[model samples]
Target chain A: MKSASPLPVVFAAFFRAGLRAKRTRVFILLALVPLLLTLLVRVVDPKESGDFFTKVMLSLYFQLLVPVLALFFGSSIVNDELDGKTLVYLTTVPVRRRAVLLGKYLAALLLAALLVAGGFLLCFLVAAFGRLGEAAAWGELGVFLGAALLALFCYSALFTALGAFMKKSILAGIFFVFGWESVVQYFPGVTQKFTVIHWIKSLLPIPPGEGGFLIFQLQPSPPLPSVLVPLAAGALFLWLAVLIFERKEYILSDNA
Target chain B: MSTVLRAEKLSKWYGNILGISDINLEVAGGITGLLGPNGAGKSTFLKIAAGQLKPKIGRLTVFGEPVWGNPGLFRRVGFCPEHDSAYNEMSGGAFILLLARLHGFAGAEATERTDKALAAVGLLESRGRAIKAYSFGMRQRLRLASAILHEPEMLLLDEPLRGVDPLWRIRIMQLIKDYGRQGRTVIVSSHILSEIEAMTSEIVLIHQGKIFAKGDIHSIRGLIDSHPHQVSIRCPQPRRLAGQLVAGEFVSGIEFAADGGGLTVRTDQRDRFFSALMPLAAQAGNEITEITSPDDNLQAVFDYLIGK
Candidate 1:
């Protein structure tokens, strides 16, 4: 019998399963928080809606939602299987470990993307309601979506690699998201570039002072390099996740 | 018969605690029962053979190739783990179909194989139900279905009959016996002597962290059956039962209960004593309430075997 490619098979199965997952439902609610805030701001102060949207996008979507969503979803790609003691089923199959990890990673990445995108679209439509005819408003929305996608990719890949390397990666991922990304993005000069958010922020159209408290003393890099760094970093992290998954022998339970 | 699995000086330990130590063994194409008490390294040995674990020392191989880090070997191998785990969110059919596709079956073939496997385990009727909705025995049958979906040449089952009802237990035992009849290699592990005895005769005894013995079941049964047995019989007339039992050649000693309702009988030959006790209980005026064999446990058998 001819062997089918395991990557697509695993990806399709997990993707469908992921959509119905309770965690996905939770993430959908998390993504909607920004849109809810956007709607509230538009109602209270119509003229200041644009500024409110920008700050919300930066603070909630970019700074919080994207990375946090990526962290939970990506880390669960392998960690959930281990905790549930279901890794044996996947690993015992004839398919390669890399195929299993990569397939599950793709499902997580797509799921996280959908959550972020759905919420961002709603927020954009509401925030840009009056400026719907303006082409520039649509362009700005495009930039935000692109930046969100890149952020999700980089953070998800990094967390996926961390998940494969260690069992309790979520706590460490929380530290990385809240502690490192939160504080380091505001650091001065080259030190700020050490954070993933810095590169993600560089892709945004917002100027230094316009981002309010979340964007203090910001220095954005060139758009081209900003895009390239995250893309390259995401690819590297994904490759690392696959490497660790393929070679590492995960002890599914306490040695019996 | 060809050796399908071989372990050479294999030793595995979790830090200070040992799993299996210096074990040299070979298993051929037949149903070989791994008999041991809990925590006796039976699961550890099966895990290594199933490629779920790596040996800390020496080596373990299946089909003349190393098991660890070898995914391709699974094409010919099926492993039913001891743990009760499954994708609770997925239906039983979906889980088995997913594994079938992973094993390289496509489209109709996958569905057909999955249906056949589920039917074999008598789970076809509940295949559409979510795993979490199923009872423990159903989940166990699902696990067994997942292993047999592809009809691999070798199967490693760790306590497969656990949580199963008596009716299904007999059916599963017959199914495993059928697999052995097909000349396939099957290694089944269980803590219960009779559970293993009911499946196949070829047995391997493990204790602590080492293989105690490996041979046919009768040899081990001989050692176990000969062990001193203590049977506590509760009857309305204790003195009558004890007086009758004392004359039997198999009776080593007898002690009557202080309450005068029962007596604990120590016998060298339990089969003979039980055969003699049945007639006495059936006789008029002698009422037997309960007959309990406290020393018939696997631990006692192991203790006697190891001590001997």
Candidate 2:
């Protein structure tokens, strides 16, 4: 008998399970941090709310919160199965391993996207409160949302690949987020462009020298590379993840 | 009978420790028990057959196809892993239904198959409960339900009755027997000899990562029965019991405990020895507090069989 495509099957089941997971609950609360901070800023300094949103809030969302969320969600796409000893059910089915990995990847991507976008929208509405009528205000929100998604996509895919390749991948992911990405993104010249945040920060609407406090020595690349680089890098990372998952053997239990 | 599974020089190891050695085996359609003690490579062999781990050297095949990296083979295969694992957040029904859908059963058919599998495993009534709420036995049954949900041709169950209650144990054993009676293949692993003996006469005794013996249970039992067994009897009057028991031809030797309250008897005929000890214990003032066979486990039996 021809089997149902396991991609949708796995995606649907994991998505439903993800909704009730403790991590999702924690992330829901984490996503609300920026919204709560935006509310605080709106009440304190009504005049410079938009300025704070573009400079400080954008840096907070793109540089810190987005990457951290992506790291947790993406690495867990494969790591959770291993730790839980539940990979047997999926692998023993009549579906390809690629389908299993991709299905989980898609589910995690969607869940993280919702968390980031939901919080960003609420924060934007409060920060750009009176200017909601202006098209430019909504357009700026659109740009920030797009950049946040690209960052999630790229970071999540990279972490997914990292997870598929190693048993204990969270440590490497922590190092990448805090040690490599944090330090390398500020390096001068082409070295700074090597980091994922560089492309993401370039897509923001904040003008140079204006956001020096949040993003010091920021050199925004051209719009085309900023968009294409993350997209291409995300695709490459996802492909690598699938490749590793399909070929590599995972020893679930200690040998007897 | 045609062979349903085959392995040629199959071997696996973790670092320096061996899993299963360079062994060869073939199994046809019927119940074949993989009997061994803990860390005797039973799980390793099953994991390799189930495609959970790749063979470090050699190969394994099911239905005439390599099991590793071959997902299509699972269409005709079902594996109930030994690990106590499931999607704890999902209800039992949802867990089976997910596997049903993945197996190509859609909508009504998937639900129907899920219920049928659960019912067969006696979990149908508790289908709506989350797996985390299920007892260990119930979770074991849920894993069984997941394996048989698709009704595949071959079933590989590793320690299926490990944590089950006595009633469910009998039922699960009967279920495996019934499945084998359908002319399908079933490979059940267990460390308990009686458990394997109850399911099928055919068994493969694995010890120290090698196939020690593979044949009818009666033949294996005969070999084990011939090995002199040490039966330890605890009593207040060890001298009286020893005096009465030392004359039997089956009794090879006797050793007094250092504590002076017990004696260990070596006998080739365990059945005869036990029958004789019953009368001794029944006599007035010859009270037997406890009786135990120190070397009755599979490991000791294996050690004897290997000439240790």
Q: State model 1's lDDT.
A: 0.88
Computed on C-alphas against the true complex, the DockQ of each candidate is 0.58, 0.58
Query: Any residue pairs clashing in model 1, and if so which?
Result: none
What is the per-residue lDDT of model 2 for residues A1-256, given as tens digits with 9 covering 90 to 100?
A: 4446788998999999999999999999988988888899899999888887887787788878898889998999889999999999999998889988999988999999999999999999999999999999899889989999999999999999999999889899999999998898888889989899999888888778888856756678999999999999999999999999998888888758
Native-referenced DockQ of model 1: 0.58
The parts of candidate 1 lying over 4 Å away from their true place are B227-296
Writing each residue's lDDT as its tens digit, candidate 2 over B1-308 gives: 99889999999999998999988999999999998878899999988898889999999989999999998888888999989999999999999999998888887888889999999999999999999999988999999999999888999999998767655777899999999999999999987766788799999999889998898988768777787777777889999999999878879999999999999998888768877887888787777765655524567878877883
Query: Candidate 2, which segments miss by more than 4 Å at Cα?
Result: A1-3, B226-296
Candidate 1 on B196-286: residue-level lDDT in tens? 8878999999988799999998876778888877777778898888888889899988898899898998877877887798789777777
True contacts kept of each: 0.68, 0.78
How many pairs in model 1 have backbone atoms within 3 A of each other, for residues 3 or more apart or on separate chains, i.e. clashes? Answer: 0
